[model samples]
Target: MDTRNKKRLGAMLLTGIVSLSAIASGCGNNAADDANAGANEQPANAATENAVAGAGMKDGKYDPPITITYLRPWGPDVKFKDGENQDNNVHAKWASEKLGIELKNQWISPSTNNAFETKLRLSLATNEPMPDIISYRGDFNLVRELIDSGRFVDAGELFDKYASETWKKAMDEDPSVWYPYMQDGKRIGIPILDYAYNGDPVMWIREDWMKKLGLSAPKTLDDLEKVMDAFANQDPDGNGKKDTYGLAIGFKNWINTWMSDAGWIFGAFGTMSNQWNLSADGKLEYGSVTPGAKQALATLQDWMGKGYLPTEAGLYDETKAAEDFTAGKAGIVVGPHWMPAWPLEDVKKNNKDAQYKAYPVPSGPNGQAGRHGTSNANGVVLINKDMAHPEAFFTYQNYLFDQFANPPIGGEFEYGLAEGYDWVMVDGKPTTDAAHTGGFAPEKYTITFDGARIPGLNMATLAKLADGGEAATPFEKKLKLSTPQTMLDAAKIVLEQKDITMQQLFTGAPTATMQMNNDILAKMEKDTFSQIIYGKAPIDSFDAFVEKWKASGGDQITREVNEWYQSVSGGQ
Candidate 1:
């Protein structure tokens, strides 16, 4: 409860105004310094050729050290040892000593609110010398601006020339990963990849509550309603008080969210809330304004009237609503596979007997189970065109992927980042005890590679172990030791449903009309949907919403989005 409050307060405070000039003053004369630094440095391309020819670039380390300057969005989550900082952490030291690369931070900005975005804008406005690499995690408009400025490299040719077979194979899993970063037939940036289906939502239920109520996992909408009814009405907590709810959800943003979401409910009806979809006639249409969505909203209104959903769900944020599940006041919550590590696990802390299981969200009357698909890549890693050694970035990145990301059974990072920082010997085995590390800082190790792992890489060993398979690798053994079986089960379910996952066809930055009227439309949509679900508005209000949506810039946004989709997908 306190943590959630603190985060909310922090968000409000962080978003409060800060002087741009004051922040930019900290980076005095960086442009001049970068110019001077480059004046004495060899042209990156010539240096690359000379090194390959003269010293013969090592499969292991460079003969001569190479330095790559980059900007970082630093947050408190990244803990540093007494002698370490962003540019000199264990990962940095490892890169300098073993990979023969020095990582110099051009600047480190806060990774909260819009601090990093503000700093980047200032840097661009002031003509700050671009670093060798720039990692921007927010605002694709900024990425577009960077590309338009022509300061960044077109990495398509460079990537083909330098990316390793392992790295290439990982990227090959999703050909569309490059679409958002492409401009004028050039790949202006390298996609920073995360796991596939990272945003696939699932039903997380308290298994003990189900057993107590003599219910099975829900297979259809009727079954789901019965379960929620049982959970809400029958006192599944066995506390002898009617203080519990069935499903946990937050609609502060929208009913659709990353966690504690109700989007899957609409998705079960063959359309997702707050998304654009292709109609049978091959035209883009807003899902929230559809008749099927009206059905979903009507169902939610029924649930609300029957006390199945939390009464204050419309007011709570995602994490605040998660408090109900964690506090054992709710039995069913829908979220992504990573729930076990968070709100679900916290339930066990609140109630020692709490037993939760992950299951596929029940299918709707349409006989389909659906969830939103996540983008294959988070953000892009852009490089300075002036930096002649773009291949050097690839060499260092590929090594990290090959060596640390997908290491052999008994490899260097089998335990953690450093001996004492991330792990310690516990009865002859490495363990991530909080006492040894003071606090966890996994984000620190990933400062390089733009805080992304090899695509589709996650808990392979643990998932296999959860299926009663042998741990074939050292990393797998460690994962099996640490991860709970519920998480593995959830991940397996997510993988099983990868085929059914859907993403927006348009992945570009917001369109011009969207920028101007998106907020107005979003507020209208949320208000109308919430009112409908809360029974404050008639179900027929959806038709009115569709008309208003089309009139108030949504139609233009759709046209622009379809244009973007056509441009990226070659009008397929």
Candidate 2:
């Protein structure tokens, strides 16, 4: 389960601002008398003055409790205990009792049907008082709008000052995480971190079919074609229907989408369609128009002509394409390491003999292999410029990263949040079964959504286990007990080929040209690619499409993207 958007905290609180003014009374006192009175009172007021000066923070707790306000999207997935709600939950109580900080929601809107975004835009247009914090995970254009509104503070300095060493090290693992939230050489939003390489593609092949057909694992493009031919032409299923296809892919929306991805095909030829890749000359280049894409398209056209793909592939989306493989109609599909836990598991229910195994993606003719890389950060946390206690947010987050993220042995959250909620005593041992624990997930009440995570920790733990290391740590033991051996092997393969993963280089907000013409250009690119694969157009049409793409604002878009990259990277 990605659960990226589901792990978010939403609420708001209003802070009271007090203004103090001194009133001068005409007592006809001379300057000398007034000076004497001040000198006499200085000694007496010293202790009170120091207390007032240190009110903001004292021993990691606010002296005068401060309230932090936020706005977030809510969904039915967010549940509450009998007496606890979003604003008065266990997390909120901990903040108040332990940290002397109050967590409050300015307002909340349903996450469904863009209600949150619509209401946020209305607030922006009406110039409403911005909350102290805003946690957003939706459209990038809206994030850009929030930044352009000039109501949020530059978080770079605050992050440097208040962020814990653990938090800083986790963020340093991927500096590009800040690119999307950056503007005018300053970080306007704090990135909400998630696990690394969670979505990187690995080929999953039907092991039963491969063994029955007497075929080996595909190591190269030529080897892959032979396997595809065997899967499509050879009666691997032995049903004598001649209905099975070689590969399962979805191209209706995006070739590089989450499930039934086709990006690895283009990646084998040295380009990824619908992404921005770093060119040899240190510029951002659109992948769809690159020369390698033409070769990839020709190959897909050949595959389609040989009935290696579903005939309705052009109409299937990511989920629909995955259904083809899960329904036992296709032999191989490409997806993340977690596929075994999901749609692939259904293959077993449908056919007891069905067995799938993950494999490394095959290399191209030149021995170069590539696939899409996942971003570690999912959303951004924006700080209000008018916020009084900015460091308080960091204090709250630092505790989560240090203690709760990868909990220490025998720590408060080692088993789960709230024993009776997410975990319960089953014969003197903790168990997370809902039947025993009452089906509660108290960690969801956290302000940062799913809580803090070190981006590289999860994969590193899995790799260690894959390498035959002992599960010594709490986190490692937990994973070893829960994760399947097949996923561990997949994680090892994914880490082994980490060098070949190509991340989209342009992570900033959409450029002016992109904002204006991106829809038309995206539709044109998808249509052209789909048509070429279906053999409705000649291979040479790709060349004409490239020329038209460059002429139709792509050239300007490329320039703007590179300029933004340079601004963020300082030209490296």
Strongest candidate by lDDT: 2
Question: What is the alpha-carbon lDDT for the whole of candidate 1?
Answer: 0.69
Give lDDT: candidate 1, residue 293.
89
lDDT of 2 by residue, 1-572 (tens): 01112211110000000000000011111321332232222222222223333657666567788899998776556678899888988778878887678999999787678899999999999999999999877667788899999999999888877776667767887889999899889999999886677778789999999999899999998999999999899978899988898899987767876668888888898987788998888888998999889988999999999989999998998778989888889999998776776667888888998999999999888787888777778678999999987877887787677666666666677776567777788998877766786666666667666677667777766766666778765566666766778877787777778888888888887789987998889888989999999999999999999999999999999999999999998876
- Residue-wise C-alpha lDDT for candidate 1, range 1-572, written one tens digit per residue: 12222322322222121100000000112322322232223122333333344443565566688788888677545667787877778777887887677888888878788688788889898998989998755566777788778898888878777676556666776778888788877788888765455556778998999999899899888998899899888988877999988899988866767678888888788887777776776766777877778889989999999999998989998888888998999888887766676657788788898899988878888797777766556667888988956667876776655545545545566666567766788788777666765664543555443333544545233344556766545444555665667777886677666666766656566788988998899889989988988989988888899899899998899889888777777765
lDDT agreement of model 2 with the native? 0.76
| lDDT, candidate 1, at 181 | 82
Clash numbers, per candidate: 0, 7
Instruction: Give each prediction's root-mean-square deviation over alpha carbons.
Output: 9.6, 13.4
Error of 2 at 549 (Å): 0.5
Error of 1 at 21 (Å): 41
Maximum-TM-score candidate:
2
